[model samples]
Target: MKSEELTGNLHYQIFGLRSLYNLPDSVVKKFELHYASLPDSTIAKDTLLSVIINRKLKNSPYIFLRKKDGEVVTIYMENSQYQQFTKFKYKELIDNKQEVCIKLKAEKLMGRYYKCISVTSVKIKKGQTLGKQGKFLLYEYE
Candidate 1:
């Protein structure tokens, strides 16, 4: 299995959202102060924006199979279950191709206090090369 991370301007949204998702307890506490002033409906969202992209991996650390409504499932018994769920969700659209490219974006409209915005995914076509944010690395078997 070979895996790599995508880090570029296009992925900034992913990076930002993940940063918010993994915020420290102390930071979250501070945000809670601001959160208190928000309306009741704003607090009910619970910070989860949405599932932008969902897909599986054929040769990487995770595997892909569709769930309800063709949603990708990462919990392939053959693959490790400890994989961390993150902001970007890449698809497994190619089986014989070398690699795939995934693009994502998010949008959140609450009050001025909070927002989580993002896009979805796109698999790189065969013979196509990586775009600005695409990266390739050898993934080690876990």
Candidate 2:
């Protein structure tokens, strides 16, 4: 039946209940533990990282995060809208010999690599030009 017909259907609800009841106990226990901590796990997935540009790779859309305690994180901007925005600001900061701190929400793409989702804040020592770059840094998703 169509999803519209399934709404408030007693038979559909019973079928779903039967399916769950037939599931293996091991699978049910795993589901319980995994879903029980969803709220906590979700919060850590989108981490807010404050980092400066280590250096921009030659002819690449990735920027490596500065090493901290020998750990280097790659920032992937290839598919993100703020690619140019990040590069421009990074160049400005480097030229002025100023510290650049960017707060962004990112998720891991691979080993020691992260895909920048949205930039929350960018702080350059003497930057004021970013205010005119539109809302390229801000992004909201459902």
Candidate 3:
């Protein structure tokens, strides 16, 4: 939906929900516990805030979330949209888990970029690529 279609507060709430999804499962549960304690007015500040994590697509990085009424959403906000957050940096990859984890700062600007760590344990066809460059990082395997 276009930014003009939703009220500012409504838009924030939806985007907030998307941000919450980036958090680890434990943190999201804590947020739910706290949110549940707020007044009815605050809890229902935006109807679209009622969303839950849905499945991720196989072999793709996209993550899907669904609302109570079955409306689905993606955690695909652009890097420029949330200045408060950072993207993963190439330097940080060495510290991240072998599978991967998330940081506000990301490695590549577009498509996917993989700075491979273990070349011997796993084999990729010498010329094959695991990821691409893109405007955003859809999801990181932690």
Candidate 4:
């Protein structure tokens, strides 16, 4: 498949919550110290603060720290799945000269943080004929 040819919408979700426990021991120790340094407060306030911090930290787009490591990783929806979208039905849309642009939300892995990223658009070649077959594109962000 040509690099510029985008077959369908990209669907991705962040997995930051899962990585909290996966951090190195040293990182965990640092987090513990930071947690304990917070000011003393009533139980409700403390719980609220903890919840807010946890959500903020986990929702940050810097949690995908692991590399592919030669393993097949499936981050977004499969090609078969994407092909099901009517707008991306290759045979009809491409044949009719319609342009397909899909915006996808993704996550970037930075050290121990997961950052949110976006795939703005994937465009198939103009005037290029498309068949029922679809292609996949893997994107990486810094």
**Strongest candidate by lDDT:** 2
Model 2, position 104: C-alpha lDDT score: 59
**Tens-digit per-residue lDDT, 1-142, candidate 3:** 1111110000011122234534667886887688678777664432334322122111122222232343333334333332222333222432342212122222221122111111112111212112334565534422
Cα lDDT tens digits for candidate 4, 1-142: 1112122422222322333333567886886687777665633544433543544542222211122241212222323323323244434554686534343444422222222343445564454332223244222111
Return the TM-score for each candidate structure: 0.26, 0.35, 0.25, 0.23
Task: Please rank every candidate by TM-score, starting with the best.
Answer: 2, 1, 3, 4
lDDT of 1: 0.29
lDDT of 1 by residue, 98-125 (tens): 3434432222222211111222343434
Kindly state the number of residue pairs that clash in model 4. Answer: 9
Taken over the whole model, the C-alpha lDDT of each candidate is 0.29, 0.38, 0.29, 0.36
Which run of 10 residues does model 4 get worst, by summed lDDT?
A: 59-68
Off by over 4 Å in 4: 1-11, 14-19, 42-49, 52-142
Candidate 2 Cα outliers beyond 4 Å, as residue runs: 1-60, 67-70, 78-80, 84-95, 126-142
